[model samples]
Target: MTTSASDKQKSTEPVTKTENSETVTKYSRLPETKNSPVRRNNRRPQKSFQGSNVSGPIFQYFMTGDDAQVATTPTKKRPSLGSLSDVGSSFDGELPEQSPRKMTICEAIDEKFSPVNYSACSFTSIGLSPVKHDKDGTVRVPWTLVLEDRNIAFAGDSDTLCKYCGNVRDLDLSHNDLQSWSEIVKILKEMPHLEQLNLGQNKRLSLSYDFSTLVQSQYTNGEQSKAEKPLSNDSPSTESCPGSEVNDPQTEHDVQKKPPVSLPLTLPSAEGLRGHRDDFVHTSLKTLVLINTGAPMDTIAQMLPRLPSLEELHLSLNGYKQIENSVMKIVEPHSRVKTLYFTDNHFSDWRDFAKLGHIFPKTKNLYLACNQLPCIDISFEGVFTSLESLHLGGNKLDSWDCLDRLNELQSLKSLRIHDIPFYANYDPDPTIRRSLCIARLKNVSHLNGSAVSPDNRIDAERFLIRHYLDHHPKPQRYFELVDKYGQLEKLGEVDLSPIEQICLQLHCSEMEICKEIQVKPSITVLQLKTCVSEIIGIGLKDFNLFYKDAMMEEAFGPVGCFSELKLMSIQLSTAGLCDQSELHARTISRHHNAQRQPSR
Candidate 1:
């Protein structure tokens, strides 16, 4: 394209305008040069201008980025959970053992509750208040910490933990990866004021494992060494120690000639348990939850004495089918524990469960729900002397005899026994189920969480009486109730069909009329009057009706329009007439006159 000299000069100069009363400068296209286009290097030199944003500054360096000596900004470093140093775990030249996938409780606590994030931590026990300065100007920390489901394997240094959460009272470390009971004891020993501790779902923390280790050490040093030195036929096989002894019964002379047989393993002495118990003392812990922690009766035996002030213990879903005799002998009678929860367990035998009564003699509340208990042992009496509440729901009990045996517990006032086969066979209605249970448990004032009043008891006992009245044999309690409140009469059969019908006898003293009518009891008073007028040929306004019930009174005064006629004898009388004789005479005279006149 050809350009004129004047047009070229105008294009090179800047164009200006006024916008919204502000001076604005516009740029025209620059003329091309031979070596390179006209460009401004922002890195070398800069020019400042003051004008409106109708045309913004267009710099050349912004299009093609600068490489050397670029203006740099420093980055801030974030704090992290350091290795085993914080927890006092020292390996001189090697790394302390830990799972790469899981974090220690100390590591998790440090990461979640660092000083920088103190304002964010929810301090639950102290009204969920965030971190704040106290009157003394020291920062107040949380009293409750929840580190559940954090894959925490180790408990960290007790001293270090106390420095951070020293005031923690209710700590929930449940659903973690803690496996060592020693690690738990470390945490408990540090927190003297800890009232509630939840360590549920840490399935590997078993005291029995430690006991087994002790037994193995003793066997290796004593019996194993002796067997290896002797190498004789008398040496016992670990697989079937009892079987080998039974198979090779020794006579008197043979017994004297050979050494006495002994098993390869031996139960830990009470002295050894005492030493272990001394390691787990926590006087202020009132509630300890170790559900599904693989802890058995031995673990419980080890813990009960240490936590002398603990009133509630939950050890559910630990595969506790039976209580070992050795463990029972080891556990001292703990009267401090008032409540115990052993639900969702493997307790099938009543005798096995009865051992708990001896272990915790004064436990008032006991929950054994969701077990395979076939029946309660009637013979196990005088054991649960202090038990007031018993929960036996979701069991395999199918007989009333099992419930009758519960009468042995004189102190049992609350009983929860639903979802059992015994009650399920009667009916699905909760009322009937509760009635049956109440009837069976005579002393229970609370059944399935509902308070059973005296009237309810009487009704339940009467229901039980009628329930078993047809059978050839009756329960012992039935005869007892009969003696207490005479023999209850059989209840009448009720009509259960839709729209029930009743037979009512209608009597009229003024007209000397008597008739029986079948009608629905649900009809209103006006509808009832219409029915009586149509059925008995009586006018609606001629007589006033009165009802007499055999159960209540001889006769109720003239029934009103709003009065009900449900299952009652109806009597009709002349309206506004006091004397019955005059009314009858008038009716008879009218009837005679009608007969004499004949049909018109």
Candidate 2:
């Protein structure tokens, strides 16, 4: 009872219908590749499931034996289109068929594809089913093959069942075409040992699942529900289907029963991540790498305080315009953080880093490279005591004097001067004079006796000269007075004619003469006259030593008739002038002594 190919074609032919007198209408069978249009139109039946308000479930259905059969209905009209025989002539011959391979999941797992060595396990693809070891006769799942505490799953085409391995500390499901959030949530809820999860580059997944509502509905008691409402009704309510009724409390409770506990983890994606705060549970996150994630700085600031154990954070290449001071203040209390990287963020000011010094005193490595920092005058001594290395390269610095205060950083070992403007301007020639280099070398430890060329010596000398010669006129006047009036003077018993003549010849001002003639003890009348003569360049050799002694007696007798003149003469002579041979030779001649007391 075998049928020919022509007979099978005729059985699937189109039915025809006849209109009033001459017109005919016909319907032809669609090609084998095209789906039946009527079945496609009727496929989408409106059936909602539990938790449909929060998330939609994927639907799959299978038809039974009777429902799979196709039925043909006869019509009264004749077909206007070409017959089946005409379509059959287009093909030259029968096409060859392909034999399907009988590769079961169990058989694929049994064949030893490769030895699962932990050191060599960089598997790009993992198929479903367990790997069977021939030697030990043991079956091991793909997840169990991970030796590291953190497990990353990026199986692109390998839809391996990610279950049963509870030891995985971290999981990365980036770049996989995971279209269902419910499936990912189910896997995450089941993997109890999972800690950190990465779902970056999964453009199809959404992170907007209401985990708070899910938690409250499942875990809260009646008292807890009364104390804290199960969910915030104030949150904007989404519209339900027009005539659909809300689920009863029992049904909602049953549907919200807690699945097996999994690790608190992260699920990130490019799309829908801006508004997806519910995906981040920061309680267990020790470190987070959010490079190129496009998360706003304000959002990051708001979220960072909640992460209790967050110790290291990397926000490189996140296109942040500026890191707010308040953001630093919020993270300042998180004492556990030891490292923070803000490299390539285009920051121009370094005043914000002063707060960082106060916040993370124990921080060892801070990367602030590739920014437009023009001036940095931070005191890195007490703050960076524990700092090992600091990177401030690729900035617009003209001098390294700003780092002079960092001499107290004893723990600082390696300072990278690569690409810094000051280092870039460094010349290897020993003759080049750089004051900043000299100062830095002098202050740094273990660098003594280093010779430095005096670069700023000219400026320093000019400054000193300006300081010393501020006033000059009074000093010059004193010098003139000493030169003119500093000479021996003479006086007589009832006459001071010689003293007056000496004052007139020198043109001495009263103050000048008083200052110069105030340095001698008492003198006799003859000695006073001799002193006055010496001042006028006259005869100082006329009086003998005995004659001078007699004049002193006469001047002091009977209320001292010439006592003032004697005192003035003695003061001028003893002050310095008449006592020295240089002054006497300049004033009076030695030959005058020959006239007074004959030649020896």
Q: List the residue pairs that clash in candidate 1.
A: none
Return the top candidate by TM-score.
1
Writing each residue's lDDT as its tens digit, candidate 2 over 355-390 gives 566665676767777777775566555665566666
Against the reference, the lDDT scores of all candidates come to 0.62, 0.40
lDDT of 1 by residue, 1-600 (tens): 999999888975656677899555555555666753444432322222221121111111111123222221111233353567443233568774542334555456534443222232111111222433333322334578888877676655444444444567888989876646656766886677899999998865754434333334332322322211222232223211111122234544454465444456644444444455333457788999988887867766866666788999998888788898988777788889999999999888888767888888899999999999996654757788989999999999988888788888999999988788987677788788778778889899998899999999888988988877786677777888778878667988898865455565666666666777665655555565667677556676544454443323335433321222332333222121111211111122455656777576
TM-score of each: 0.57, 0.36
